[model samples]
Target: MGPVRAWRDEEEIELGPRQQRAVLAALLLNNGIRLSNDQLIGMVWDDPTPSAVMALRTYVYKIRKTLPELNLKSRDGGYTVRAEIVDDCRGEPLEGLRSAYFDAQRVRLGDSRLKAREDCLERELDVLELQKHVAAFPLRERPRALLMRALYLEGRQGEALDHFHQVRALLIEELGLEPGPELRKVHAQILNGDLTLPRRPEQLVPDLIDFTGRAEEIAQALRTLPGTVGITGMRGSGKTVLATRIGHLVKGRFPDGQIFVRGRDVANELLRAVGVENPVGDKAALWREKARGKRFLVVVDDVQDAATVRDLATPGSAMILTSVRRLHELPGVTWLKIAGLTEREAREFLRKAFGPVRADAEPEQAEVLLERLSRLPHPIRVIGGKLSSRPGWTIEMALLQMERESRLADVIPSDCAAMMAPLIAAEKQLSEPERRMLMCFARQDAEVIDSRKAAEMSGADAGEIELVLESLAGVHLIEPLVLGRYRLPRFVRFCFGLRTAELTS
Candidate 1:
């Protein structure tokens, strides 16, 4: 009615009370159609006298002056406001000025469902309610983000972009934090201005994988001050898997990031991976350079020495490294050698791999099988795979096979031996009596023993046990438990045990 009004707002508009009431009254009466002089006078000032007509004219003049600036107008003897008809084929209004209409609708409806008497009218209101929720989303990175979305919907692309940038800059200065990942992706899309929207998969929520058995020890380590976690264990003893899983739990709070690196005392293998061929002693510098600019969740697996790992960690990056030995001399790095998977996780892994064996499918047999598997993931997997192929095989049958190989001292593969080559070389540097004591202890069947008992078994003096255990612990051959207690990480134990047994034989 008023030149097909483009939806617009006055850049700045302030009106006195009388002017505001008078203009609002006219717009309400003449939503799109024009209001004649007499009609305007009756609407704005209820008096029907001649001066009332003059007052209406004065109000109309002031409104007209402001209206033009916002693209409204008066023509001939009447005042008219423009109505925008969106071009939508299905009668669903196209975005543009209609977005302002939607925004107003959302505000009016709020959270309440609109009700109507007629079924058709009720259906229409329902559609408007849904459209309001979709188009006028309340959560955004900032208020200006919402404003930008509104303007973009209203076909004011240029203004929307300007406002978006202004908001981004404002947030950057106001909060030191950068825009979140979601906001960054949204901004990139707006900058591209492609109408196509991306649909991302809903994130899968996390569930706790049952880590029964070691709960107390793991909890104690996790609760330790400074949050530095160190894990050492044999290959295939669940050390790597446990480190990764725990790192994930710890990283939620350290969002600047966490790092995991597979470390070896022999740094050359990894040095080659990070583009350091012929790496001189400056490997840490090369490593730090590679780590620069990335806020990472880093996992260094196969760690052989604490010093090597400390050298690789970029401070401020929470780090998790795995090794088969403890490096006690390396200060500040928290030392925690990971234990084998508890009886439960190991059994679950077996059940998953074996596709439900008689032990799980048959409750009477479950306990018997769990005992035979000894709660070690590698052995459990091997045995489970074997059992899966031969369903009728009894747990006792698998136990016999496990017992034979399990007692064969150390049976680590040559490739795994390659992983510990540098540590092996470091062991050679130990004094002969220390080496012989390690060899004798390595040949023993048990995985853990007190230092005094170890000395007795190796025929060494009790006083000498502490000093030798300290030296071996430094090179990571074994880890001390308490004052006199000590245990070997599965892999380190297996490797050394194998070596010690072979040498003795």
Candidate 2:
């Protein structure tokens, strides 16, 4: 009687003695199926008694009298609790008695009815709860798929995709396997925008809730001539943030959709964004077809090479590529170089990030903290999040910690290591001379180094050094100053110095 209890309306009916309960349970178990007199006797008493049949009869009579609604019928020299009453019974069957079968039946009932109830807000909530319950079971794809469908139907496509990714991540992490094809099919359907919902202009890029500056840059990117605009900046220079802000502002122009791709597989990401599944031969061709006549905005973020920009770019669609490397000049591609925030912009960023209380109480300390951070948006955001989470720590304490700890890991959040990983990877791809030229800046006292100066330090050809410097600048590893000189950011210089020390020592 654990999860199973007999209830007659508001009253709980007593099922009577042990033998009587056993008999009632047996009839309920074989509900609608007649149980022979011999079967009932065997079930009632493990060892048949001379009077077991009579005892069974008595139990049946008592159950009938106790619950008249059961319609327990004696037929073909046997007894059966009618089939209709089984549906009304709330509790599960006795242990080892078709529990698996019954549970599946219940799930099927819920799943089959989900589509009918999706249009009702109240019913959809109930379906969500039921789907959540079903998803908790192992190897059950139907529930999660239905949940995704239900969410899409409710006009929460982003949440739907998010839920699928969570499940996919968990499965891959825990079991070393991907979700089943059924789930992938449902995901493809959602991405394709098959569900009939009003097409409101959607901004798929996450909101920059604490977005601080870049007003002029955002305006320029929005007004740029119709073509791909390349945004190059040092790692964590707020290129992606600025691009996303531009996407949101110009989303009104692209009524079809706005897609943001962060992965290396540009073709599949674009296809998936617009709802294509398992694209076959000629990925670029397929991308063009799907994007044809669709005035959408595509923001390809964290691009490492020019080929990706070329592959993802579709004619007639506005494309924004954010990268650390300067892409090889492609036709119709205008470049936007992002620099660190100005003094005023940096101060306002810190004020907003640290909140008014700290900014107002210690204006000088805030300024000192921003200066130590080199006015870069990434560190400011990372350290700002850490400070906000720990109210006991002040801006001055953070500054002191950064000064005392020279290692990037010690000064910045652990996740910042991931942001720097791409730059490190890009460095690995360079030739020995190229890498040496960039490392010379780390060994130099001056912040700015010209091609001739770098050639003198590294003993490489001045023209070759110039090319390396240009490559480095293209990737935003070093900043290009006026008069053909390049300078590394203080943070990048520090990182390079660390790498140089490691190689030498």
- The candidate that wins on lDDT is 2
Residues 103-207 of candidate 2: C-alpha lDDT, one tens digit per residue: 554565454344323323222345457465555554556567767777888788898899889889878888899999978988999999875432323546786
Candidate 1 wrongly placed segments (more than 4 Å): 1-228, 246-260, 263-294, 329-335, 361-374, 403-458, 466-505
Provide the clashing-pair count of each candidate structure.
14, 3
Q: State the weakest 10-residue window (summed lDDT) of model 1.
A: 114-123
Would you list the C-alpha lDDT of every candidate in the order shown? 0.54, 0.71
- lDDT (Cα, tens digit) per residue for candidate 1, span 292-406: 5333345667665556666655554445556666556656667675545666666666667566546566554655555533445655555566777787887667556544543
Whose TM-score is greatest here? 2
Consecutive 10-residue window with the lowest summed lDDT within model 2: 115-124
